[model samples]
Target: MYLIPGFLKPSTSFVPFSEKTRSMAARTNKDNKDASGKSDGRPGLGQLAEQHLEDMDACIQNSGLAPDTLAQLKLWQEQQEQTLKAWAKRPGREHTSDADRFGESLQDWERAKATFMAQAAEHPKEDSTARDFFSHSSAKRVNTDTVMAKSLKQQYPNLELVITPARTCNLIAYAQAGLASFETIGESSGKNPESLSWDLYVAPARRLDGAQGGIAERPFFEKYLYKWRGLEFIIYLVDGRDGSQNYPSVINYYILTPTKDKAQLLILEVGRWGADMHGEILVFDGGYWQKSGELFNSIMKASWDDVILEPTMKQAVIDDHLTFFTSRETYTRLKVPWKRGIIYHGPPGNGKTISIKATMHMLYNLKPAVPTLYVRSLSSFSGPEYSTQQIFAKAREFAPCYLVFEDLDSLVTDSVRSYFLNEVDGLKNNDGVFMVGSTNHLDRLDPGISKRPSRFDRKYYFPDPNLKERILYCRYWQSKLSDNKDIEFPNELCNAIAATTDDFSFAYIQEAFVAALLSIAQKSKKPGKSDEAGWTEDLGDGWVGILGGGDADGDLEKLVLWAEIKKQIAILREGMEEKQKVQM
Candidate 1:
C-alpha cells in the first residue's frame, strides 16, 4: 500500500456551492480557462483514470503478493476504472482536492495483484530469468458457485480449480499448522488495490468466546494469498450481493491453488471449521455443525448445587455421568460396547435442563476437556436421515463426548426413528459416546428406544421438587436478593413460599418468584397527577393491604415479596389446575 503522491484522504477544506457556482460563472473572461484551467473546460476524468492506472502498475511491480493470473485482474481494472472516471466528471469536483479524492478512490494492490497473479498462464519456455520463482504457475478460478467465478473459469479453460465454500472449511489455517507453513501478505476489496481506497464499516456483534465480535475491520471485498508449505495460492474473498429481496451482502471465497487435491490432507486434518472450536461446543443444527459459545456460556453458569432435587438423586445423577466417562476400561474388560445412554424423564421444568448444563460443565473441566457435541435436531438440507448420519458420524469421531438429545420426543419422530435407532444400535461401536436424552412425555417414545436397556441403559426421573427442595430453591433466590435494599427476603419466607407453591414444578416456582418480584417493581403514575415524571414503585391490587398481617408463626407474611408471592401463587395455582384439567 505505497502512498502514491496525491493518493490520500478526504480534504478538510471546503468551498461553498454558491461561491463555487459564482467562481465558475465569474470566470466569463474568454481566456479564464473555465473551471479545469484549460482553453475549454474539461473534468480531467480520462487523465485521472490514467494516473490511477499508473499508480496501480507501480504497485504491481513492487508488491510481490498477488495471484499468478491476469484473468480476474484485468476484469477488475476495467470495472473500477469506469467508476473512477464517472466520479471525476461530477459537478461538485471544484469543492474537492484531487489528492484527497484520488487517495479515496485510488487502490493499487488490485492492479499489483493482477500483474502478480494476473500474469501469463505460463512464462516463456526459453527465456527463464523470472526472479519471482513462480514464473510458470497457472490458476483457474474454482468455487464456481458464483457467476463471476464461473465466468473466470470459462475464460481460463486450461486452468485447474479446487473450489469450496470458504466458510464451510478452513484450508489455509489448517494447512498453516499441519500441512504447511503459510503467510498472508496483503488484502483488499476491489481487484485494483491501487484504485480508490476501501472504507471500513462494522456492526456490533455479541462476544462469543473471549474477544468482542463485529468491531474489527471487515474488508467488504478482499483477497488473500497463502504461501503454504511450498505452494503459492491466490484467494479471492469477495462480499457481493446475495441476490435476494432484502439485497443484503454475502461473502463468497475463491482459492486458486497450485494444484487440485494438493491440500487434501489439510482439509482432512482441519475437518469442519466448527468441528473443534476452542472455548466452544459443536451444536448440530441447520444441517451443519455450528460452533456455539452461547451454549458454552450457559454450561459455564450451571452448577450442580443450583439443581433443586433430592440430595441422593442429585448425587446419583452426577455419579452416573462421572462413572460412565471413567469406565471405558471397565467396559473393555467386560467385553461391553464401551458406550452408554441415559434418559432423564419427568414433567417439564423440574431440573432437567440445569442438570444437563451442570454435567456439560463438569465434563469440560476434565483433564483432556471432553467436548460436548449437542444434537439440536435431525434436520438438514439433505434430509433428517442425512442429518442423523452426520450426527452419529461426528459423535463417533469425537467420542467420549456428551451427546445431548434434549426434548427426545420431538427430535426422534416416525419418519427417521428407524434410521436413528439403527445408528444407535449398529455394530459401528459408539464407544465413549455417552448419550443423554431428556423428555417430559416418556410414554410418547418408542418402546424400542425407551424400554430397551441395550439402547438407553438407565433412566433418571426429574420429578417436581418436594417441599424440602422447594425451600432450598426459595433460599437460593433469597441469597441473590440479599444485597438489594428494595426488597425483604427472610429465611422463614423461604418455607412460607415453599408451603405456598404446593403443586408447582421447579419451572413454575421460578415463574412465581419472577412474576412476584416484577409486580413489586412495577411503577405507576398516580391518578389525576399530570407531572410527566410522577411515578411510584408500588404493588397495587390490594395485595399489600390483604397480606399486611404477619403469619402467626413469624412476620413472613408482612414482607412485600411475600405479599406479591401470595398473589402470584394464587394466580399460578388456578392456571395450573386449569392446565391439568385440559391435559386430563
Candidate 2:
C-alpha cells in the first residue's frame, strides 16, 4: 500500500529503473506504514518525496560510472542548487491579493519551463545525441538529489559532528599525523587575497594511539583521528606529567567544504572570528601554551591618570615607549629594528605590575589592537631555551604585539642565558614587537641578558612614591571609599595618612585603606555604636597598642590603625628589609 507523491516524477530518460531503487522505496513505504496506521493521516508528503529521492540517488551512485563523469555530475548539481537558492531570494513583484501570489507562481513556473525547453532543444531527437543527453541529465538529477539528502543528514546527524572551514584543517592534521603528512601550500604576501598567512596540504591519516607517561611508569592511552563527519579532521592529544600524576588533553579540528547552505557557513565563520577577536592572555604551562581566559585585572581598569608616579619617570618609561611602538615607519626610516624593550625594576609592592596592566589595557584598545602574550614561567618545559624559542615564535606570528616577561631574572636563568639573549637580539628581525620585562632584583639577572643594549635597552626604576605621590595615592583611595554613603571620608584623613606613611609603597597604602574601611563596616554594626562619633572612634583606634591613638577629632598617630593591617605592614617592611639586606 505504497503511495507515490506527485513531486516524485519519473525521469524523462530511456534508462531502465534499477531493482535496488525499487526495493529501497518499498522498504521506506513499509516503515512509514508500520509507524502510523492507515486510519492516521498519510505520512508527510515532503518526507515521502525526500525518501524517494534518496533511494534513487543511492541507485545512481551504485551504477558503474567513470570517476570523472561522477565528479562532473556532482559539480553541475552544486551549481543548480546555488542557482535555485539565488532565485529564491530575488525580490518578486509586489502583490496585494491571493490572485497576485498565484500570478507570481505562474510566472516562475513559465520561466522554469522555458529554460527546460531551451536546454532540451540543444540535444535533438537524433538517437546518439538523445542517448548522451538523457544519460547526462539523469546523472545530474541524481547527484542533486543525493546532495540535498546529504545536507539534511548533516543538519541532523546521529553523532556529534563539529564543522569548521577547510582553511584551518591542517592545524588539526598536524596534530594527528605530525608534520610529515603535510606540505606547505602557499604563503601569503602583504596584499594576499586570503586572510590566512599560509596554506597546507594535509595527507589523510587515520586513528593512531597516543600515549602519555614515562616508559618506566604506567602510561595512559588516547586515540587521534584524521577524519570525522564524512570530512577530513585532525585530532591532537597532549600528555603531560606533574610529579607522578599524568594530565592529558585533546584538540579536534574539522574542515568543512563550501556547500549550498551559505547562511549556516557564514554564521559559523563569524562566530569563530568573534571568539578570536576577544583578547586572550596566553601563558606557557604543562609543556604547552594555553589561554588563561579574558584579561580582568582590577589594575587594568586603572588608567595612566590613576597611577601615582614621578612625572619624569612616567614621561620617559610609559609615554616614550608608547610613542615608539606606534611609530613603526619612523623606526624603518632610521634603519633600526622595529623592536623595543623596557625593564621595570623596583622593590616588591611598588607600581611595577599596576603600570604593566595599565599599559596592556592601553595597547589592547589601540586602533588595530595589540595582543599581549604573558609568559608566567618556563620551569615546566624540558629546557628553558626550547620554551623561549616557542614563546618568541608565537610572538613573531602575532607581530605588532606586546610580550610581557614577568620576573626576568628567574625566567632567563644561567642555563638559558645564551638562548634568551639570542632570541631577543638575534639576526632574525623582530619588527613591530615590543617587550616589557620586570624584575624585583635587577642584579640577579646575567649582565649579558640584562645589560645588553638591544635586548633590554631602557631600564626604569619604580621607587617608593614620594610624599606628593603618596598624597595622590591616598586621594585615589579616598574617592574609591566615598562610594559608600555610610563612610564619611574627609580630605584631612587622606592628608594625615599620606604624611604618616612616609616610606609605604602604593600596595601598602591600599591595604591600609581596605583594612580601615572593613573595620568601620564591622564596628558600625556593633550594638555600642549608635552615633557617627562611635564609628569614628572605632576607626581611629582600630589598631590598639600598635599606635597610640584614642579619639578621631585630633592628630592621628598612624595612617591605618587597624590591628591586622598594622601587622601586615610590619611584616611587609620586615620582608623588604630582609631583601635589601640580602642585596647589600
Index of the highest-lDDT prediction: 1
Ten residues in a row with the worst lDDT in model 2?
1-10
- The TM-score, computed over Cα atoms with residue i paired to residue i, of candidate 1 is 0.61
Question: What is candidate 2's CA lDDT for residue 88?
Answer: 33
RMSD after CA superposition, every candidate: 17.8, 19.7
Error of 1 at 191 (Å): 9.7
- Model 2 score (lDDT): 0.52
After the best TM-score superposition of candidate 2, give how far the Cα of residue 575 lies from its true spot, in angstroms.
7.4
lDDT of 2 by residue, 559-582 (tens): 344343455556667876897899
What are the per-residue Cα lDDT tens digits for candidate 1 across 1-584? 32211111112121122333333333323221335755444334345445555554554344332232322334445555444445435544342344345545644554554544433323311111111111111234322244545543543334455555445565555654465444333323222331112545553354543554343454443444555556666554554434333433345555555456754533454565435767788999978788887778767767776677898988998899899888888999999898889999999888887788888999999987778989888787789999999999989999879899999999999999899999999768799999999999999999999999878999999888889989998877776565554566777888888998877887788777767755665632434323212112112111110111122234775677788889888998999889889989
TM-score for each predicted model, relative to the true structure: 0.61, 0.53
- Residue 467, candidate 2: how far off, in angstroms? 1.3
**Largest TM-score belongs to which candidate?**
1
